[model samples]
Target chain A: MSDFVQSLRLWFAPGRIKDEGETPDYRFSLANERTFLAWIRTALALVGGGFAVDQFLPDLRWGVRVGLALALLAAGVLCALRAVNHWVRCERAMRRGEDLPVSRFPAVLSLAVAVVALAMVVVVVFGWAGR
Target chain B: MTEVRDPGLQPERTRLAWRRTTLSCTVVAVLAVKVAVHDDITAAGLTGLALSALVWVAFLAVAHRRIRALDAARPHPLSYRGALLAAVCTIALAVCGAAMIW
Candidate 1:
């Protein structure tokens, strides 16, 4: 628990980066930040979807509805968590004149989206048929 | 901190990304606010509403500062503080959203 708090502290400590790393072109860091923001938007979208699932699918099996919503909410949390880690790692790599770490998030997130889309499609099909 | 003669448009593009992301966050936050308003305003719901707006403001502020730094030709690596701020805000949003939902 202490370690986790420490890690959180470290993550939040912006000034620690003051003098580290060889200063590269400003564009690199800007691009990295843009990528981080994009992930955050993705997470926010998932949360919005969670609300939509909970609200619109009144006829959905409560179990399935809740499960799907929870999955989406959890995925959003994962994206936020990963966004920081990726940003920091990428920043550190740039500072050290090392290769930026490859991100696997896009693939994972796409798969999650596929799962959600498929679930929604099934739900829609049934809803249309029942109507 | 030497200025690179050819900084290109990447910084501008990145700033644009920040603007888009913050805009999306704000929209979602407003949606959360709508949900809270429709329901009885619980503490969690209100907190989510406030935090959502706060996150957007904070993100814009930091992005602006960083972009300014870029424009000023001080090519510092992106601040870990800014990254952490984004992370904390984004995660707080998720947590507050859960509070509203749950």
Candidate 2:
């Protein structure tokens, strides 16, 4: 449908977010930017790590290695998307003079990383690659 | 009234952050090239290498623009254009990663 296509385009476009209210202090904005950039670095780590694993870990089981690589790539993309949302949220909170919203991402990210590491350990220790 | 507040070297910090981001992108691009070389000279791999190179160049250019804007004496507007560019590049790299993996 035309409507569906339009929405998809909007989703891909960065203009969906509008900075409402007054521009906050440059420091706050800069801090928000730094945070966003930091997350972006995390994203780079994920994507780059994914490619590295895919290239080097021929020893890993096909399904498991492929799945892990895909998971990491997906995670990196999600991080990029989420970084924008977080930056916008912070800016909004600053403009309204409201407390910045608490982000549960750290906890969730930690859990996810742990699970991935465990999966890798299983792959390595069990020698799933050869079988 | 213009919101007059001391930027107090904040812009410099922001510029540094942006540089760091550009640096990170460059590193990722190099890694992608390395991987592509390992994967043999295939179209997809070569495309990934080229795309990554383009992204790193774009990132550097955007960061340079940001720094130039910050140097202006007047209060400058901070646009999300660069951030969007960075995010889109990340997504593209993700696809490239998936492609190489598959």
RMSD of 2: 4.6
DockQ of each: 0.56, 0.63
| lDDT of candidate 1 at residue A82, scale 0 to 100 | 84
Candidate with the greatest TM-score versus the true structure: 2
Question: What are the runs in model 2 whose C-alpha is more than 4 Å off?
Answer: A1-19, A128-131, B1-8, B72-77
lDDT of each: 0.73, 0.76
Which 10-residue window in model 1 chain A sums to the lowest lDDT? Answer: A3-12
lDDT of 1 by residue, A1-131 (tens): 67346436557575554457676666777777778888888887887777677776778877788788778888888998888877776776777798877767789889989988998899889878998
Model 2 chain A: which ten-residue window has the lowest total lDDT?
A3-12
DockQ of candidate 1, scored on C-alphas against the true complex (2 decimals): 0.56
Flag regions of model 1 displaced more than 4 Å.
A1-21, B1-7, B39-44, B67-70
lDDT (10s digit) by residue, model 1, range B1-102 = 565533576656666776787677776666667655665877766767777678767867876786676554435556677776776766666666666666
